[model samples]
Target: MNINKEENHVQSVVRAAHILQLVANSDHPITINQLSEETNLNRTTVWRLLETLEFLHYVERDLPTKGYQLGYAPYRLFSKNNMYLSLIRKARPLLEKLRDEINETVLLSVPKHNGTLTIDQIDAPHSIRPINLVNRLLPSHCTSNGKLLLSRLSIEEFNLILDRELEPITRFTITDPTLLQEELNWVRDHGFSLSLREWDESENGMSVEITDNRNELIGFISLLGPYQRLSKDKMLTLAPKIKSTAKEIAEKLS
Candidate 1:
C-alpha cells in the first residue's frame, strides 16, 4: 500500500471520530457549520461525514432546528452494555420497596445533556397516580430529579443550560434564570430537591442523589405522586426514607 494514501485514510477516520464526539457532547442539537467550526474542518468535509454517519444510524438530523443529534445506533450499543442493565437490576428491588412503603411512584433517573432521563420506575399502586414518566426526557429547571442532577454539574456546565430558554410547563415552573440559580443552590445545600406542581399541575416530586464509590453523583432516586397525595409536608416527612433508599442503591452499585 502507498504510505501517503494509508496515512490520509487514517486521518479521515480520525476526523470523523472527532466530529462524532463533538455532536455527542453538545447540550443542544449541533449544526453542520457549528461542527465545522468546532472541529476546525471545512463545511464540505463536515457535511460529508455527517451524511455518512446519518446513513449508518450513528447520527440524525433534528428537523426543527436542521441540526444533528445522536441517533439510534449509540443507544442500541448502550442498551447492550452490561453496566446500565446491571444498575437497573441492582436498583429494582429497592425501588419496588420504596414504592410499596410510600404507595407512590419511585424512579431512577440520570442526567442527559441539560435534562433528566428516567431509566426505570416503579409506578404508584394508586389508580389516580401521575402518568408513567419512564424513558421521558424532562426539563432540568422544572423537575425534582432534574434539579438534583443539575446541582451536581459544574458551574460552567450549569451556565450552559441557563443560556437556553427555560420553558415553563406550568405557572409554578421557575422560568426566571436568577430564581432557578438560587433554587439550585438551595438544592445543593439541602441534599434534596422538589418539584411542587412544576412539571404538571397535579403532580409533585422530590429526589435525592445517588453517588458512586468516588462520591460522584451518578443518578437520582425520585418519589412522585399526585399533589393531593404527595403534599409538600408529606414529601418533607418522607425525604429521609428516600435518602436512605438512595444510599442503599449507591452502596449496591459501588
Candidate 2:
C-alpha cells in the first residue's frame, strides 16, 4: 500500500464504514446487492469495500444464508477506548446516590477484550449488611453486565459468542448459547437486563446499557444485591430508574 494511494483511499474507507453501519443498523443480515442498492454505490465498488472490510474482520459473510453481517472489528474498536474509565470516574457520585437510594450495591461495567469487567462499585451503606464488589470480571453469559454488552452485538456476532460455549456459573445460569441469545434478544428489546441468581447463586442483578447521544453503547451501570432483598417487583421498578440514570450520565459526559 503506497502512502499517497492509501491517503487517496479515504472514500473507500468511509464507504466501507457506512456499509458496516448499515449492516449493524439492520435487524437482519443484508446481501451485498442490498448494501449496494442502499448505499447507491456501484456493485464493483461496494464489493471491493465489503471485501476489504471482510479481510479486516469488520464484516463476515454468512455462506449458507448468503448475507453479510458485522464482525469483531466494531467490538474491538469499541472495547479499545479509555473513555470507559473516565465515564466511571464521572459516575461515582451517581453510583453513590443509587446505592444510598436503594440500599444496595451499585456497579459500573465496560466491555473488555473477551468479557465484561467491573470497573467501579459502591457498597450499600447500612447497619446490618453491605456487599463489597470493587473489581471483578463476571461471566459474560451469566451476569446482567454481560447481557447488556452482549445485547449490542449483531445476530452473527451473538452466535459467535454462543459458539464459544457459555459456561454456567450457578444453577440458575444459562449455559446454552442459543437459549442465552434468546434471553439477550429479550433484554435488547426491553432496554434492560436482569440476572436472577445467574452469576452468583444468592445475588440478583439488574443492568442498563449506557449509550451516547448517537446511540452508541458505551457500557452499563447495574445494581446487585441479595436475591431475597431485591424482589421481582423491586427490580422492575428500579429498571427504568437505572436506564434513566444511565442516559443522564451519558448526556452529561457527551
Most accurate candidate by TM-score: 1
Error of 1 at 40 (Å): 48
Badly placed stretches (over 4 Å) of model 2 are 1-85, 127-131
- What would the per-residue lDDT of candidate 1 be over residues 1-254, giving only the tens digit for each residue? 12224454687777778888888877669999998878777899899999999999999999999999999998787787645677888999999998999888898988787588888988876888766676788888899988887777788998888788889899999999889889999998888999999999999999998888788878889988889889999998998999999999998987
lDDT per model, in order? 0.86, 0.80
Provide the lDDT at 226 for model 1. Answer: 87
TM-score of each: 0.67, 0.64
State residue 184's C-alpha deviation in candidate 1, in Å.
Answer: 1.0
lDDT of 2 by residue, 6-102 (tens): 4556766667767888988775679989988888878898889888888999889988878898898876777667556678778888878878888
Model 1 lDDT on a 0 to 1 scale: 0.86
The local lDDT score (0 to 100) that residue 23 gets in candidate 1 is 85
What local lDDT does model 1 show for residue 157?
90
* TM-score, candidate number 2: 0.64
